[model samples]
Target chain A: MVNLTLIIALPLLMAFTMPIFKMLNSKLPKFIALLTTAFNLIVLSSNFTEIMAAPLILELGGWQAPFAINLYVGPLALVAAFLINGSAFILSIYNLSQDYQFDDKFYLLFLMITAGASGMVMTGDLFNLFVFIEITSIAAYSLTTFAGGSSYEASFKYLIIGGVGSVFLLLGIGFTYSAVGSLNLAEIAASAGLINPLLLQITALLFLIGIGIEAELFPLNFWVPDIYTEAPTAVSGIMSGAVSAAGIYALARIFFTLFPAQQFFNYLLVIGVITLIMGELIAYQQENIKRMLAYSSLAQMGLIVTVISLGTEAAVKAGLFQLINHSILKVLLFISAGVLISAAGSKKIKDLAGLGTKKPTAAFGFTIAAMGILGVPFLNGFISKFMIISSSLNADQFLITFLILAAALIEIAYYLKVVQKLYFEDLEIEVKNTAVITVPVILLTLLIIGLGVYPQLIAEPLEKAAAEILNNSRYIMTVLGGI
Target chain B: MLNFLEEWSFFGGSILLIFIGLYGVLSRKNMIKILISLGLMDTGVNLLLVALGYVEAANAPIINSVNPSNAAAFVDPIPQALVLTSIVIGTAVLALGLALVMKIYDKYSTLNISEIRGLKW
Candidate 1:
């Protein structure tokens, strides 16, 4: 059995040692960071069968159960960790081709984000989860400003918003500890029924709003666009792909395991629908490509949240599938946007006209991603979207079904507009070479199509992940070991 | 009334500080003041966490042979550990925020958030 702790620890070790490597060789840090993430990806993938068989519980310091911090390696957590490390690895490869003045610091923060994200999904202790969240946010905040200029403003906005979110999370944690006299998620969950109903509700709300900020839910995601637009493109890719996936995982973990209530799922349904509509509508009006993509990503997150809120086994399975699809699609979109923006030297839709013909590889990759996100047939996104809609219908949620379709129509409208501009619009300016980023873009595109063609490749794992999420008793048992 | 105030004072004060911080973040125009307010909120949260673990005349949770039988007499130590970590993280965030504000001032030549409109809806 692979030590589950290494998944979180390896990246942290690599991140902290990056400075020393930088001192040895100026170009060494990026290479080390890349190798570290690649190693972690391999390690994570190798343990798939083991994790799928049974959840691996790693208690820290050799202590037992609620007395010690533990890392829970269930299928749900494994899927999230895979997404985080997988995207980080790809982004690291993309980073290798780019030139930055502070490459060392960039890699340091990058690796820290990966480690923190991995830790966030795996840790079973509430305070430990908070610590990991802080680690991730701190790294993210610094990374937002890595490009300087307007990024400082973007980072500051993220700080203010994320800082406030952390406060809410801490307050919620305090309240939970006070009520349950325990910090372990399983123990708290087991004893949750004994807590005051009103206090429980308040704590649930506090956690929802707190984690909602990171998950990019509507009303809490105002900082998303600015950060995505202003931060470096690679940072945007990781933020949207890896960080947001972890956020959603954290949200799902909390709701499903800690506070599984019918009313809360109803609230999630309402919030998800609103977020979907709001993100899609606003995404339609965005002139800048990054902002458009950011808003669209938000809309996709809304869809996942909505489906997960359904609380049906098939719905949760579909939601996890969509979450995976969104992460892959966002990585492709943001990285392609990064390449396109760099090629055109502008982020405006009109400014990037006809680069599709100029840079056929990137344009092709972006088209595949756009189609996948638009739920085009023979793409991964189509399958997940179909599953979610069908499951909603099966559950007799006709209103939700209609709203989701309406939101998809809005999604189609905006993404199609960008597609038209990419291929049909006349060239207004010369485009730069996109040779460096084309590899990852093409790889992700192929993955999208391959998955779409045969989603059975991931169906078993996603089903297990969904079951892991819905099986609250199993989770409690894994952590508390029959109390 | 006195008993209620004494019992709930710490919790109430933390909530009050959090609200004040939120107000400052929303109402204050200056960037530095906003950061300071964020610091206030962090401090308040830390205080509340420590207060939650407080027991009426409890000793510090250092258990040695002399105090082996007095484990129950000591206060809960988990919240204190959490607060320690939280305080460090809060400081890091505060420093990062202040650094960003410094850079914002350099780029825009203004501290007013409303004026730093490089990005918007």
Candidate 2:
């Protein structure tokens, strides 16, 4: 069996040794980072069968559960770790083609962020989760300022908001520990029934607010657009793909395993609806391409949150499916947008006119991504949207079903506007297409279409992931067996 | 009043500190002051975590030759460990925030956050 600890250790070891590689050659760090992520991807894939068979619990320092920190690698965590490592590998390849200052620091921060995200998903302790969150945010904050213009301002704003969010998260962990007298998530959940109802409510709300900031839920997500727009496009892609997915995983794990309150689900549903409407409506007005894509990403996340909030088996399954689709689509959209923006020398939608003719492949990739996000038929998004809508109806949530469909219409409208602009507008400037950028975009586009045509390929795994998420008793038993 | 103070002081005081820090973050325009407030809030959280693990009249969580076996007399070590990690993280964030503030000052020539609106909705 592959040592699951190496999944996090390898990237971190590479990140700390980045300075040595930098001293050897200015161009060596990126390759080393790429190799590390590729290695991590290989290790993770080789352990897929083991993860699917049973949750792998690694007890650090040779201590048993409830006494020492542990890593609970379940199917849900494996799915997220795979996404993080896979996206990092692809993004590293994309990074190799770009020329930027501070190359060494960039790769170092990138690897650290990837490692931190993996730690966040796999950690079995609440305090460990907070530590991993801080690691991810700190690395992300540094990466945001890599461009050294408005990026500094964006990173500062992110630091402030993220700092506040971490405080809340710490407070929630403190409260949970005080109540349950254990820091282990499984132990806390096992003893959750004994906690005071009012205290549980307070802790739940604290966690919701804390993790919601990272998850890009409605009120706390104002930092999304500015950070996404101002940060380097590769950073923006990772932020949208791996970082946001980790945030969603954290939220789902905490809510489902620790505090499965019906009232909280109602709160999640209402907030998700509002976020969906707000994100789409706001995205329609954005003149900048990255900001538009960022808002659209937020709206998709809101839709997923709504599905998961339904708390049904089918709903959670559909939510995970959408999560995977959104990760792939955002990566394609953002990286392609990076290519297009560099080609046009401006991010304004008007400035990008006629690039469809200049770079047809990238333009087509963008169009397909836009269509997939809008849930057009024969797309991966459509399958997930169909599942969520039908599940809502099955749950007899008529008003929610109506609201969701309404949000879908608004989503389609904005995406159509972008697609029309991409293909139908008059050519204003010529664009230079490069192979490095075009290849990843096309590869992700193919993955989207492939999944769309054959949804059954991921159906069984996603079903098991959803089951792993919903079965709190199994999680508890797996982690704290007969303790 | 004494009983109330004794019972609620640590938790209440930490909550008050957190609010004060939040108010500073929202109300203060100076970038350095905002970061200072963030540090204050982190300190408050650390104190709260340590307080949560307090046992009445318990000793520090050290096992010595004299008192090696009585676990109940020692304060919980987990929260202390958590606080230690949190404090290190807090320091790193504070340092990073300060570095960003320095850069923002260098670019804008002012520490007022209201003036740093280079990118907006």
Candidate 3:
């Protein structure tokens, strides 16, 4: 019985209030942000079942379905909400301990990023998705450089790259609208084929490049490492975990709802495989911890793409599960890396040698996250990786499964290399200070392990979500207003 | 002039602009130049969006027409709305890019991306 509108509106309203909190006090904004995200997470998770059962649809401004902005809520969108707010909550806790300036504007931008992403996941219109993408990009560009000097530089590069991506997306959305004469996604999905095929094909390509930028696919991923490395670790946590997940979520929504074409799905398959091979191959060469994680993020996205391209109910299910797990675990890994970098006095993996013995708990969190990502048994990463592989196999996409597994091996290769460096080797230099292991750090560590062990915690809802996404008939009926 | 801009080639040509911009980004070394190249690509894409809704001889969409059915023949205004939003976003990103370039210049004193390898493995 939770009101879905309130959940969606909470973040948007916070965007406005975030700025004013700065006038009151510097820390007020972040404190407000943490409180808001925590509240939204509780509200969304508590009503998770009610919304999933009925899948509440709200039309903005009382405009009728096809013509107005619509908010569509289902288990799929709710899962995205949970992952975003949950990680955002943890990252805010980490931020509370750091002494950074511009706290007000930073948190304001952060709230907008969260709101924009949430809007993308919940919106039912093609045009609205583009609008959300714009807001998300602006917020992301600001936050990417919010760490200051070099951060500004990285944000600049990211802005250019992101700008290109947005244009591609806008062109795609425009073309889709022109062809079908409708901005509603479900309507576009139903009627896209009736439009000129060539135009639709081109639009699909545009959309791919557009979304691909945020998704951190190959070639377009140049901005990712720089942004991740230079930006404040708190913001990077959201970027890798929440902001970035929004990209994959939007990609899934558009592909399923606006242009569910066989030919394009096949293209997705090839492109995804390429990203998988390239992302992993390059990640192995990285020496810097943040850049290494950046490459790993690409590799993870490639796996999500691969699973999604399989385009079966099982494949979609596995992909969704992996997507959530990747977001959560990646955040944990990035934050742990941030803590290590700050404590260890060096960014290079070789510099981090032997420190784990000195700081067991922080390193332990890193160990759990790294092992989970490598699909080591009993870790959350292992469960999702197993599901994606099995789902692809069940769909009889053997070659893709082989490639994904090969990528996983590379994943293990790099993850273990870091693990070895953390445990076995000692830094040639004298040991320094370490980031304090606080309650939030302990909580994140425990959650990663808990979810890793009981993956059914996520899998059950993902099953419902997968079924709902593949339920094209029901989706079309809702948007098209009955047969 | 309006009729000329309304041709199907406009869309095709815009695609070429995107490819050219991509080439610039991939091949260019100067950070500022690469940014310009990105701008070129964005322009091309935005033009394509505007071109998508071009119906020759149509006017700006409004309900001023005496008859209801006649309004269907007017230019599609949806693309115009989309373009406005896209243009605004593009501007924000470009400003952000320039600001970053200024900051990077202050730190590194050079615009050459190749020399900017402080974070490299």
Best by DockQ: 2
- Quickly count the clashes in candidate 1: 0
Q: What is the lDDT of residue A15 in candidate 2?
A: 84
Q: Score each candidate by Cα lDDT.
A: 0.88, 0.88, 0.79
Q: How many residue pairs clash in each candidate?
A: 0, 0, 1
Question: Residue pairs in steric clash, candidate 2?
Answer: none
Model 3, residue A281: distance off in Å is 1.9
Evaluated against the true structure, the overall lDDT of model 2 is 0.88
Interface root-mean-square deviation for each candidate? 1.4, 1.4, 2.3
Q: On a 0 to 100 scale, what is the lDDT of residue A238 in model 2?
A: 92
Tens-digit per-residue lDDT, A440-474, candidate 1: 87678778999999999988789899998998988
Question: Order the candidates by TM-score, highest first — what do you get?
Answer: 1, 2, 3
C-alpha TM-score for every candidate: 0.97, 0.97, 0.91
DockQ of each: 0.75, 0.78, 0.56
What are the per-residue Cα lDDT tens digits for candidate 3 across A1-483? 556666558877887776677777777877888898888787887787786676767788888876767888778888887887787888877777776577777887888788888887888987788778778878888887666756776776677667767767776776677667888877777886687888877887888898888787766777887888888787788888987788888787777766677788888788778878888898899998898898788878878977887889888988987888788788878777887887787789988888688777668878888887887887777777888888888999889989998888888888899889999988766656644546666887677778788877776678878887777667777766853
TM-score of chain B of each: 0.85, 0.89, 0.82
TM-score of A-chain in each prediction? 0.98, 0.98, 0.95
User: What's model 1's overall lDDT?
Assistant: 0.88
Over 4 Å off in model 3, which ranges? A428-437, B1-48, B54-59, B62-73, B110-121
